[model samples]
Target: MKIDWVIVGAGFAGATLAERIATHLDKKVLVVEKRDHIGGNAYDEYDESGILVHRYGPHIFHTNLKHVWDYLSRFTRWRPYYHRVLAVVDGKKVPVPFNLNSLYALFPPGQAARLEEALIDEYGFGARVPILKLRESEKKDLRFLADYIYEKIFYGYTLKQWGLKPEELDPSVTGRVPVYISRDDRYFQDKYQAIPEHGYNQLFRRMLAHPNINVLLNTDYREIENEVKFSRMVYTGPIDAFFDYVYGKLPYRSLRFEFATLDREWFQDVGTVNYPNEFDFTRITEFKHLTGQEYSGTSIMREYPYADGDPYYPIPCPENEALYKQYRLLAEKESNITFVGRLAQYRYYNMDQVVDVALKTAEEILRGI
Candidate 1:
């Protein structure tokens, strides 16, 4: 079909851009998604037991940007959700980020008190210190505390998630693991934190429901690229694949999810539990905690990081990033194509971040049109 713009991959990136272009600019846009559904990895649906579950994994929408939050609010109502995660460290489940409350949970009262005082004195109250930065402390007690957290929490999880040790990976990856001096156990401290009321699929449907937008599911763009007539293209798939891997395929980490339905109402104390030093899988997420759904039967998903399967996470290492830069240079030379999203950019981005970039890209494309 003839169209003004052809969007590849109908996830948040492509869907958001298509909505903006169709609604604002009143342009005819065709969105081709390889998957049967939209929303990409953020896709969620009801299972056989009638409980809503994230098909890919848990996606808690949290953003400090008011515009991004407000933009998405146009399509879906908000379900206020503050995500809490616990890690199994030393046979006890404690709050993640190795917070002060966790300090007391893992150590004796006297020892925890001393360590807390030292942390407060050094970093001040409520300060979030990166685990790597905390490890560089000159103080013996602080160093020991960092070491304890590294071994018990960060080390094994990184190994299983990325197939690399904490130190072996990029600093940006390891730096995400921090030590919170406050008792706040919430995984994110954003100003706006909530999930879409109906689920991400519903939100995507509303966003792409404009008359000027046409959606074709289970259709690979590559198969129809030569036949489809379009003025410009927005690609959200892997950047390396778009260029036929001229610089070789960019390394990506995938996930294998195992879902279980139990006869109980709830499964865990928190939304997610990390098994850093315990199991082959990184974590287990209960759908009830995430969806806030009350049902007799509950569902939980176990995420196992794998090297095969569809690309889920871009490997954040120096070598992989450098290889992506080479492909990026080729992408920049393509005047008619705009590459946006996590896979296209080869960066780890949150859902809101992806939306923000897509909106910006759409604005730029509209100006040129």
Candidate 2:
């Protein structure tokens, strides 16, 4: 069998490129996926209780890029949503980002007021100050506030999620762990925040529903690469695995999710609650809040980070980046292959970013053709 393009994986990266190539370029493209289904980690479906749940933990779509949002808007209608996360600190559930409201939630009125004034004076009202950067403050009050947030909110959570302290990871990651100076409890401050109207699965199905695109699920690309003829390849799987771990393997942190269907209508006040200082799991996400599905019962997922599992998060450290750089240099030499997405690039990316990358990759492919 012959095809214009052979794309590996049926996730956003692969699906977007396949759709673009098939629709714009009018070329036959085959998408081979190891999983039986599509949408990659963003896949969602109604649980046994009829509540929509993300198969791979909670994925809240929030992005500042208008082009990314506009592109996806073509496939599925949007459900306006703003994601909020709370953490168990001193037996109280406060906002996860440790914002001004979180400060008031944990501290006494007078002390909270004092600290709030100090924080705003130091970093302004809406400024986001990284915990590590805040820790560098010469002011005693700001220093104390930074230490408090780091210990209560970030320390245990980071330890559980990444198996390393905030300081041990790359500064790019640690720098993202910020303490918002505002009273906003929303996790992301992006310009647009929403979920697909039906679900991520529906969005993916519509995205890959072009006449020139063919999805072959439950099959690895390598098994049929020899039998099929294609001019170019677009790979969205792990970069290390594609190269067969020639330069050893890049480290990754995996997750174990435990989903429970409760008899109650709602589990928590918000979409997600983090058990930072206690429990083996990092957080519990209530799916109803995310999907806006009105149901009799609630379905929640508990995420536990571990070493041995499917690669979920690429560990952000100098050694891992160095290893990925070596693989990237090798990938750059392959002129016919276009590598995109989280696993292929070995970098953490938001859902919108993945789509943006695939769109740009498709444009590059079309330009060359």
Candidate 3:
């Protein structure tokens, strides 16, 4: 039962690290995932109508890091892609990122230009007087901004995602949201953007193809038959569960989705459209927009947030963080285990940050090994 390392969860955090450590460091690792799949939430495969759908939810790979992009390139060639978003407000659909195109599309042409000038004058972006950093004026405040974003783009969607009004959640939760001045509607502005040409599952399959990495799907980490054989264990599962919930389970928000196959060729021209004014669901994502697969049919998903489930988004409130601290302190006392990834760290991180953290954590662990 001897092994060099026991890595838990086969998601990007563990799978990417396993590839690096086993290939370069020549470490014999046992990779165990609580779920039945290797790709975790990023897993995608062809659906009934030949649409490559995101099984858990929609995820776009966008990162500013070149090393990560290069490292993953070893696994699969990327399909050149750019992600965009739209909002449905007052029966009008427009681009997200709040750009000029969306402005002109939303308002009458002349009024749109006037509003643009006024907004730019008030809130200069990337300039000496950046609106985001400036002190609030008598006219500008939390209430004003929240109301504006909520009414036009975020309120209904936020309500759909959190099951609460935008006012109920901390502004910090929504603070990272922006009011962009440029006409660029691309949801993310990154150098390299793509879905794996084959698929995410294939990339992960190649990532864990090394002889030294043994991946066990359909087996939860808790069900590992072997006992204390490895020198160290990296547990990427939920931290509260790792400690057996001694600190009362840390809060996490999850989503439930209803996917459908439309008889039409397309649902929307854009990939995603946020229902800022309609539907209990936050947004509808058309798989056709994401995958670029050609077919007479299409697939769409309506995302509904739930208070309980597999713990997607960690609750951002300080009380939840304080509780996570107790579990972390207990994890610190464990001599042979390391916690990693979103659930383990109890933070909301994008795909790149998780991959970067996994790479860094693997580097630290290699020194120890």
Candidate 4:
């Protein structure tokens, strides 16, 4: 095949770039996906019970970036879903981020009222304070609240998810767990938050349907790299793997999902219910809530964090970052190869952020060409 660009991985990163190059730059692009499917981690499909479920895990599309939302709007319509997550604390489901509403959910009326007033006085209303930052407060009430959240919500879940204590991991990872002073139970406050009307796979199919774009599924780029004729390469796989892990393998945390189809209309109140202090798995996600599916039977997935699976989350630690920097230095020297996406960049990025990065990378490649 005569290819102007070879895109490794048919996820958002590669698919977006291939579509842009084919439609805008008028280049023939070849997308090679190792998986038998497209859409990478965001892939979703109907199960045997006729219930739509996310294969990898629950991916809620929420981003404040207008350009990113506008770009994806070309492929699929929106479902306008506002994600709500609940953490099982003290035998009750409380809103995650440990908001004021959660305090009322878990504590008595008098205590919850006192804590809410104190929080508003200290941090002001609607302020989002990191759990670690709140823990450092000189005030006794705030410190107590922080300790409660850290112990009940953050500590156990972080330990299970990353296989490390919350304090042991990088602050960037731990600090992401915030305590919102407001009563908003929504998981994210991004301006635009929704799921694709159909599924992510459908969106990917539309994105890669351009005449100049060719998709090769279940095909490894390494197997065909020598045979294929392409001027430039866009790699969306692991950066270390691309260079054969020359600087040692970068650490990543993978997940094992156990899905079950139950003969019920709904499973949980929210889309995701986090089992922080109870279960071995990090959380359980009910797909009907996220997908807005009206199936008679519901499907839910239990995410068990493990070390031996496809790379899911790049472990955010000082040592891993330093090692990835070495790979980045090597990647910079390769003029024809461009690495974009979560695994390739070795950073934890949301779906919209990955799309934005791919768009920027595509523009850069076009200018260079």
> In terms of lDDT, which candidate is strongest?
1
Q: What lDDT would each prediction earn against the true structure?
A: 0.92, 0.91, 0.79, 0.91
Please identify model 2 stretches exceeding 4 Å from their true place. Answer: none
Task: Flag the better candidate by lDDT, 1 or 2.
Answer: 1
Clashes of each: 0, 0, 0, 0
TM-score of each: 0.98, 0.98, 0.92, 0.98
- Position 171, candidate 2: lDDT: 81
Measured on C-alpha atoms, candidate 2 has an lDDT of: 0.91
lDDT per residue for candidate 4 within 44-108, as digits (tens), equals 98899877789999999999999999999999999999999999998999998789889889889
Candidate 2 shows a clash count of 0
The weakest ten consecutive residues by lDDT in model 4 span 168-177
Q: List the residue pairs that clash in candidate 2.
A: none
Kindly give the stretch of ten consecutive residues in candidate 2 with the minimal lDDT sum: 170-179
Per-candidate RMSD, Å: 0.9, 0.9, 2.7, 1.0
